[model samples]
Target: MRSYPVDSPHAAGRILALTMIVDGNLVGSELAALSRSKILDHIDLDHADFQHLLKDLCEDLLTSTSHGAIQVDNALIDSVLEEIVHPDLRRSLLHAMWSIADADGWLADAEAVLLTRASNAWAAETNFSSPSYRRP
Candidate 1:
């Protein structure tokens, strides 16, 4: 995957896009939830830019595919997760991810895996003890 500056809008958008596709399908409900939440605006990313980032992420993942199956590199995902350094940004992004995962009314195992991985990774860097971080 192409590199973007730490905490850059592109990085944030890429992560969000990854969340949308982690389940191997991008549903309309997920897109609608993202649009309604306006989370991209929080990172100064417009819808057009977000779509571009999503496309770029898809291309990157496709390039790394082997034998017709996409094998996502954990190191690459970690690097992208590390790009968002701010605690507030991490929290917001996590929230957006959870929202997207739940948008279709069913959380696939793949979605849960990505969400758990991101939450654990970010929790190690920042204090997530607050009740807000708890799932209802």
Candidate 2:
């Protein structure tokens, strides 16, 4: 078995592709923030590399995040989200989460909270729904 570098830039396209799946209500600033936030947290995430990883990641996530009610129900949706965030992809997800939260390089309290909830949820063994922050 060959172990891959966790911070390898090869996955950049994949990240963007996955993120592109989720349509609507994603403020462009937010999405751009998300991408940037993820890279910032991972010291090795070069801005140039992200451009590449995004394509495949978005490709992986396209159908799953397709337009819909911001689904908080349905086992299938959860499963799909979980599948989309598979362990390998989870790194990218975490990276993306940080990217969103840290995009501006100033961590707002709310964004910090959001990052904790998401990264923690994604890191769980059984993949429990990420703890939520009440809607503002």
Candidate 3:
């Protein structure tokens, strides 16, 4: 998979893209939820750029799935999550991911695993001493 610079908008968009496809299908509701979240604006990524990032992610996944199986293990996830070191960006991405996961009204096992992994990883990396720090 192509790697973006740490904390770059493309890196952030990649994580969001993974969230959209991890469940094996990208539904309309998930896209709608992403649009409503306005996370792209926060990350300084426009819709067009985000779409490009999504396409890149899909291509990478497809290329890696030569055996007819897509392997998205925790180590791969950690590598992606490691790109976003900013606490605020991590929080925003996490919230957007949750919104997308729940948008279809049924959270699949893959979605739950991704969400939990991201939340736990980010939580451990961030200092939660501030009173304003809240898990999204």
Best by the lDDT measure: 3
Clashes of each: 0, 31, 0
- TM-score result, candidate 3: 0.92
lDDT by residue (69-131, candidate 3, tens digit) is 998877888889899999988889999999999999999998898999898889888863487
- Name model 3 segments beyond 4 Å from true: 129-136
Instruction: Report the C-alpha lDDT of model 1 over 18-117, residue by residue, as the tens digit.
Output: 9899778999999999998889889999999999999999998899888998866577778889899889999999999999999999999878878888
Q: lDDT score of model 3?
A: 0.91
| Alpha-carbon lDDT, every model | 0.89, 0.46, 0.91
In the range 2-89, model 2's lDDT, one tens digit per residue, is 1124434443333333333333233467557654455434545565555545544444444455475342223432333443344655
Of candidate 3, the 10-residue stretch with the lowest lDDT total is 126-135
TM-score of each: 0.92, 0.35, 0.92
